[model samples]
Target: MVEVDNATLIAFTVLALLAFVVALIFTGLSVAKKSKLFVNTIGEVSAKYETDITPATYAFGIWNLIFIWQAAWLLYAFGSIWRYADGGPVLMKPDILPIEFYLFWISCCLLYIGWLFLWDREYLFYAFIDLFLLTGCGYAAVAYQSIALNNNMIGLMSKSPVDVTLVYVLVQNGTDLFFSWTTVATLLNLASALANDPLLKRNLSAKSASTISLVILGIMVLSWSLIENTVWFDYFKYVYAWYAVLLWALIAVIVKNYDRTNYNSVFSIVLLCLVVIALVVKVAVYASRIS
Candidate 1:
């Protein structure tokens, strides 16, 4: 039997608490703002595509209900972790695989769910799985985002263009921004997860956060450029890349100055400038090509 030290146990408890808080905040904000956008966008897309699927047809209303349930479950999981730390029985089996493994599995499930949407046929049963997959992935992402931001290992592994491109391909072909955004959201979540971990509390420095944020921001910029060049005329592609870049940039600024009051104002200005330049150049080139 492996003996877990008191310090290690305490650290895990703190980490769980932090993850719970962060997840709660994110979900609350998402539900408040993004959920409306999601419904509206889906309605618009269906209309544009001339699809018969209505918000009701695709169970959008029910999805919000499921999301609330999932958020409750996540809170319960975190509470269980905290309870187990104080000499209680394990709330969840430590025998369960590492968080990253769970994240990967959730990602695969999300991909599957998105694929189901590609068919003209509606599978109402699959909607349950889709909701489950989103909840799982969102939870895992939040739990791990902090950790990855602090550790730098997960983001490093995700550095390769080929690897990132593969993820992008899956997202594109899946034809669902929900899956793509969730994947990206998880990357951010990993950072949040590590931020609250006890072991990493001391080891996770401001510099590390800044570096991780910068790297992710760079990836977002590169991805935006690629999408702009490849699908310049597609409004959807532009919107996707533009919003993704903005989100990553916001994250970078937040992480880069995690401990500072002044924050990365200079970097934020530079990033905005660059984005404008990139957009202008891409648009000009696209127009020239069309002419």
Candidate 2:
């Protein structure tokens, strides 16, 4: 086990704080519908790259939920450090996430901030790369959280009901929600990048690229549901939050592409519907088993 020295801890805290400040500033600008660089707001930039797989405007509203949940978790986690330090009384295993988790999160934040800038500047390929890296970082953080939980490094040491709930609710659920959304966003970014970049499109038409990417995302979601129902059943608690956010994205896409006359739209809708059904059934099965 790597020991976290005072200097390392201080560095992590500063990075996290800096990331939080950047996020808040971006959020404020978004809420105000104002951009420092004229005509470079996220919505404005994304509209320029709209592809067949791009979800409807409402789908992006999920950022509100993501930001709120993330903020709540960060506050609780930070407060727990001062409130429960030295094992004062109400101990919480996940009061402070592991060093690996912080490292991954900080990297994700940096990449996300950079991706915004790149996307705003119309650097589609580079923006996609940044989003890809950000998604990978989110996945790594979630993976580490899973490992910590499975190894009895988090929830296992809880001392109170609040601690136990916070362990899984604020920590696990919060991370999963953030990661799942990022995964969807990454797929959207890839489709947009491919559609806009001539070299990346190659022999594929813009519509074809979007359709293929949509199918890929559908298959990915279905595979995850199947795995959670079988292989990961005992290893980790069901990732209900991930599936829920993904379901939201799929529904938004289906609503947007509800054109019966278009083959690409109809085919992609059917594939995504199948994936949604799989997610629903898997969640029902998990609930039944627990009940």
Candidate 3:
């Protein structure tokens, strides 16, 4: 309901898009700066603290897909802006979007950059809070989109599903995809933090470490089950790729670290079984969605 004139909207949109580019650059820098030898240069820096929930480095290659889609969305937005200069009445509509949308979106972008810095610095607790804020703003955008989906600006209104516009495809669907992955990313990152906090690893006994990991896994599965029955049930499918990535990470850890000389095979086996079951559920849900 916040009306934005053509000139103001164009300026704001361009600025926010630039901010996203900057944040992405910083993230890419962090990735590039990671320790080639040991990978301890970045945050969460300890081999011993790694957990089954942490995805292998290659799993993050999904960023390529995310980046391409984001670039396409930005290009489409610029095209919409150009329409206003063609004597079109600012092309003012939900598709072009109001000021409030940009505000929430820019906040998400900013929070992500901040979150990255905190995460890279190994501030696990603060990074968790940052992820909460980042994801909260993202979900807020989703809520706004749901309301505006049926609004007259886009004018598909109640017929959104059947007669979707390009705006719906790029803007609306883009938001959904970004949010879906971030939701999973946040949880996986959080679980990794819990399992690999350096201080805890130094202080806790071997048995305690295994016990804590199991507790964390149990809580995550319980949380997943609760969400499964809710309106957000689709979240499970969104998380499937992450579970698959984690499976790979777990398998790698077992290959490299699971030995009687250093680790408990019984605990490792139990851990593997738990994650495998979770991955199976995630795969099943994802497949069902495709079907």
Q: TM-score for all predictions? A: 0.34, 0.85, 0.63
Better of 1 and 2 by lDDT: 2
Model 2 C-alpha lDDT per residue in residues 1-291, reported as the tens digit of each score: 244654465466557757866876765664355566434678877787787777889999998888788788777766554564335423233323567877898888878777767777788888878988888898888777666656654444544445555757876788789888888888787887777765464645568768777777777777776777787765446456876787788778778866777776787667667766876787687788789
Of 2 and 3, the candidate ranking higher by TM-score:
2
When summed lDDT is taken over every stretch of 10 residues in candidate 2, the lowest stretch is 87-96
How far residue 206's Cα lies from its native spot in candidate 3, in Å, is 11
Candidate 1, run of 10 with poorest lDDT = 49-58
Q: Rank the candidates by TM-score, best first.
A: 2, 3, 1
Question: Compared with the true structure, what per-residue lDDT tens digits does model 3 show for residues 115-228?
Answer: 777776676657767887887887677556545544544344332333245555666667656665566566555655655556444444434444455456557655654465
lDDT, residue 207, model 3? 44
Q: How many residue pairs of model 1 clash at the backbone?
A: 12
**Candidate number of the best TM-score:** 2
Q: For candidate 1, lDDT tens digit of each residue in 34-140? A: 55422333334323322110112333343353344444434443444444422442322331113452344345444433523421122222433454466456444
TM-score of 3: 0.63
Candidate 1 wrong stretches, greater than 4 Å: 1-180, 199-202, 226-241, 244-263
